[model samples]
Target chain A: MSALLQVRGLSRHYGQRIGCEDVSFDLHPGELLCVVGESGSGKSTLLSTVAAQLAPSAGTVRYRQRDGEWLELGTLSEADRRRLAREEWGFVTQNPRDGLRLNVSAGANVAERLMALGMRNYSQLRGIARSWLERVEIDAARIDDAPTSFSGGMQQRLQIARTLVTQPRLVFMDEPTAGLDVSVQARILDLLRGLVNELGLAAVMVTHDLAVARLLAARTIVMQGGRVVETGLTDQILDDPQHPYTQLLVSSVLTT
Target chain B: MTPSYNFAFLDEDTKRMLRRALLKAVAIPGYQVPFGSREMPLPYGWGTGGIQVTAALLGRDDILKVIDQGADDTTNAVNIRRFFARVAGVETTEHTVDASLIQTRHRIPETPLREDQILVFQVPEPEPLRTLEPREAETRTLHALADYGLMHVKLYEDIAQYGHIATSYDYPVLVDDRFLTSPSPIPKFDNPKLDRSPALMLFGAGREKRLYAIPPYTKVESLAFDDHPFEIQRWEHRCELCGSAESYLDEVIVDDRGSRMFVCSDTDFCGDRRAEAQA
Candidate 1:
């Protein structure tokens, strides 16, 4: 079957620095693919390029529309990209601070995506925000509290809430559980897994944590030196890594 | 001769209009009052709102501090301070504790403000419901009726999908626990400063032509759900320059290759610390 998202010869560079070179991938609907890489592996650059946050220097990222049309992400105008981002794509950043508008109330933050998509009913928006807060294990009483007052785990959950509120078909998460405690990280990973399964949302998650990838992604891609080193089923890759880099990563996880 | 710009770059008529709007803002605390705004020399979306407020409030006795994203030396802040110095002929200080009036574009000063000091915020859009209900007329009716059903629904949907309320900046709030207000674009980190602040807080939206104020000691609550409350971003790292843990920080790109150093965004706050160390 044709993929929901297709990238062909995708490349991005920051002047002399190679962000990503000759990178390509395909993501199917309801599938969670985790792109694992180290600090300078261009993992973030790849995600940002796909999310239209960063313009690619070369190649194409095409998204299959509901109407069976294929639209090149880079070719779309700014307004068009914004509309797509609001209507079809949800992006979650590594830092909850960058992902959300921290000054707004949690309810406002959740409601904002809907508002951006032109949903105009205050009572309904509040109800939705309250419901989501409960789902994220946040007490309903603090819906009006600013995200600034939230703990790191809660903030990441809120970022997830903000993106998911719109019910976009595609969700891109960059290090969703990076800074949270181990327990919080597990809970968030579990939450994400349950939600993705229930909503049938296609997701591309970028993380350095191999365990996190195994828990949430069906498929895994290992990247090193701004290039994909391996790609396969999460279980297969974890059990029998092909590339030396993936082998090292798997070995390191086992030792620790 | 092309008429040279006024001392502060804003024309006299604009200053007069701002003066009138400011009086009304002061009179009706927490009320967003509208005005017939004039074109300012500065861009409409920039610090024109704060500049107008400063122009109206400037007096020989007052000292001013302007900060953007909490930094005093940011280009925008520097320009604003220079504007006041040229037009108002008032003293400008980089010490947040010493300033009588502060015109801030984004982040609030890190120093705990005194009752005598007043904070003026430059707002891009004053209406909290603008993003929800694009029609100003409809939103006004909703506000008047205290109807906020739409906001709740959006939050609920977020729960259904992501399991949390997602928002980062320009967070909404309940002013006086009644009207929903936008606390400008200050990071959620600074929203706590709005609650019962000793200093009076004013918001001006030049493009939207609105002015609002929160009187000293008034209650300002950020909007949230019972289960999921609002939050601000916290870093395990402290400010590298001032060694201050409490201040808002800007992540500065130190190298062309993306190396970063987090420093206090509030220049006046940093300067005061440096001065204290020297002392």
Candidate 2:
């Protein structure tokens, strides 16, 4: 099968300091890849560069359009890039507050992307928003409630529903479950697993938790000091790690 | 005429600069064009923008009319009219049909504007997305991209909360199907008059230092959903004085006991109707 996205020697530098160096990967349709690293290991930087949020200092990121055309992400105009971000792609921030419009109702938050793409019928938008809310385990009755009134886990779920309402081809998640409780994290992971499978979405997730990689990601890229130290199947990387950094990450997981 | 100040209280150079911005604003229908806003003798909120626009456009032969909330004799309207008469020495009239230039605040005239007339709107806040998105830089980018999802979200919130789009005034509109323009706080009842109108409509915000326009025959569509379509406010009580059911009405309290009566908000329209009936 052909890859949906291709990153070739992608490098981002903060002047004299390296953010992420020589990160290359091929993400296929329906593939879920996790970038596992410690703090300041360039996982977030790589994610941002790949998502076109931050301009890479060097290298090319190519995305295959729905019409079977390969588009050079760097070459796209700002308008074009913003259009792509709104219409075809989605970003789920680490904080639900960052992703969801807190002042607006839950329905409006979920329906915003559709409205952006010219969906004018309010009832139709509300209906779609309702279904997505149910899909994300948010009660349809609370559609009019503000995200500010929601609990942390509910807010995260609402963020997921908002991002997925447009049925985006690719989604970038930055530590989606980082701050959630263990029980809440497991539920969110389960919901994400079902969604990724049902929607056939390609996702690049950045997380420091190895258990989360095992739970949701099919493939894992281990990073250390702004470099990919190991890349393999999530099970293989956790079972028999090749790199010393990968070995430490796998060993660090406390199995109670 | 006294020649101490230049024509219309602004110097020739400043008028030329304002004319340039006004021309650009008219050229790009509904797109807000930034301009150098001069401090008028009046305070910022008291129709400074509309006064500047009228001053720039007023000629010696023009008849000017100023209205505040559709009333021609209010403090704001009277002061502005007096200001123009003193500075420009132009003929001023209260009749909407007789005026060549009409500077308005908060309402459009009940009488239909003709091809020869020009309508200048005094805008307090020019950006339609200002309330939704606060950052000026981000709002500019959104306008450039025609990304008005925030506007729809606002409408959606209104519907979800109030069971309808509850925004009564300053409703956002897509002008000429391109720029999302604010119709300068005019009631949504007057929104239909903006579409395909024969007269040119210019908007100016003195505090904001921005100007925008809707050329004759331009499309001005209020933002709405197909299900929850754009709607205007309706009045159950007709004008008690003029007995006109079609005009925008203001409720006037008769006594301290809260006895009130509905009257035509447009004083000129009401007076004209009364005169016609008497005739």
Candidate 3:
């Protein structure tokens, strides 16, 4: 019933240049919010600022802890912030190579978060990693193989598995399906939707693809020139747009 | 002392600066303290770090012992001992127990050290995460966060490939339950000897300009998994000359016919054992 994440008037600036301005949202448990826009429209800046990867120029981002305490992201020490990032939160990058440790095996990649949280038992970690790999449709037989040896799709799936293995409550994804072939992108999108729904995860995803927003996000926010143009339910925004930017976005996509 | 050189081959001011850094290193117990490293007469890789530490700690009455790869007669060992003898004019000994200060490379003495004794190690690299994460800034952040998951990944890869941790010398260790440190290329066989030891252990890296210390009776754990635990190297044969089976052994080629014999890596320990047998 309560909001899991609260953002109030979040703004980030690159000196005099505006990155994102006056963005406010509430993400509830088991909810997915997608921010869709053209490139350089502040979608990524909003995500990174909210995720505490970049400093906010104005406003506060608060997250509810597992213990039911509200933590102000701006006030947390560097150590506590890093701990929260590794233990409670997960970030899935656009490139799987950036998200996954290339030198380590797939199993180690999945088990890295657990190990970071002090899971000392090797067999238990390996077992969990193997099961997660299978759940993500990666062959369990390839657990010991380097992620570089995997195809792009498989690598992305492995990255998702690595992020979700720790069972993080909220995940931040930045153009996760970007740069993949269309078929591969469709498969990854489907896999992501299933996993997000099954795990009841609250996620904030940044994507330029409106179709991706429609497929994954329950609530959608459309941005233009670092400002929110329109926001509503995914279906309503796609069907009946109120803002000029929203109408243009709906018309620009190739609707079947 | 030699007329041309100051005591211990270093100026009084340099020794004082080194002493300050050594104090801070000892106080933090495994945290690397940065110091101004001066060029020594010896080459950089050839125990320059250990020599500086020795020069700083050497006293008028302190007996010095230097060893390279557990041998007292190796060129590195002999030259370092002679270097100290000529500069500081201090007493130098080959016996481990008789010496008050021990400067070593790549090995720990087989004989257990006493509380009064101090062990100095020549370190080529000070940072344990250097090979895994190339960025010094990122590695420092990892250490500050105590996030050592990258280390486990390395061990995990070793297990996946060779079925166990293949790292023999220079294995990683968690010092004082805080800093992940490099144990200066000592075989994993000696890793256990580092835990709760009576002697003080100091590590110096001249090339890296860092120094760290482990006071007596501190916890030193070699990184390993629960199922894939840490294990040491073992030999099937005993030392050929001393007939001691417990010490670390080195394989020696005996003849042109491909016959080989195992000998104790610690020459002093092997000699003492042979002397005891003769007695």
Task: Say which candidate scores most in lDDT.
Answer: 2
Candidate 1 overall Cα lDDT vs. reference? 0.83
Query: What TM-score would each prediction reach against the true structure?
Result: 0.53, 0.98, 0.98
In candidate 1, position B4 carries an lDDT of 60
For model 2, residues B151-262, the per-residue Cα lDDT tens digits are 9999999999999999999999999999999999888999999999999999999999999999999998999999888888889998998899998889999999999999
The parts of candidate 2 lying over 4 Å away from their true place are B1-3
What DockQ results do all the predictions give, each relative to the true complex?
Answer: 0.03, 0.88, 0.69
Which has the greatest DockQ? 2
Q: Candidate 3, after superposition: displacement of residue A19 in Å? A: 0.7
lDDT tens per residue, model 1, B96-142 = 87899999987788888889999999999898777656788888766
lDDT of residue B153 for candidate 2: 95
Instruction: Please give, as one word, the docking class of candidate 3.
Output: medium
Q: Write the residue-wise lDDT of candidate 3 on A46-136 in tens digits.
A: 9999999999999999999889899999998889988888888999999999999898889999998888888877889889999999998
How many angstroms is residue A23 displaced in model 3 relative to the true structure, after the best TM-score fit? 0.6
Tens-place lDDT per residue, model 2, A1-256, is: 9999999999999999999999999999999999999999999999999999999999999999899899999999999899889988999999999998888899999999999999999999999999999999989999999899999999999999999889999999999999999999999999999999999999999999999999999999999889999998999999999998899888988989
Error of 2 at B129 (Å): 1.1
Worst 10 residues of 1 chain A by lDDT: A115-124
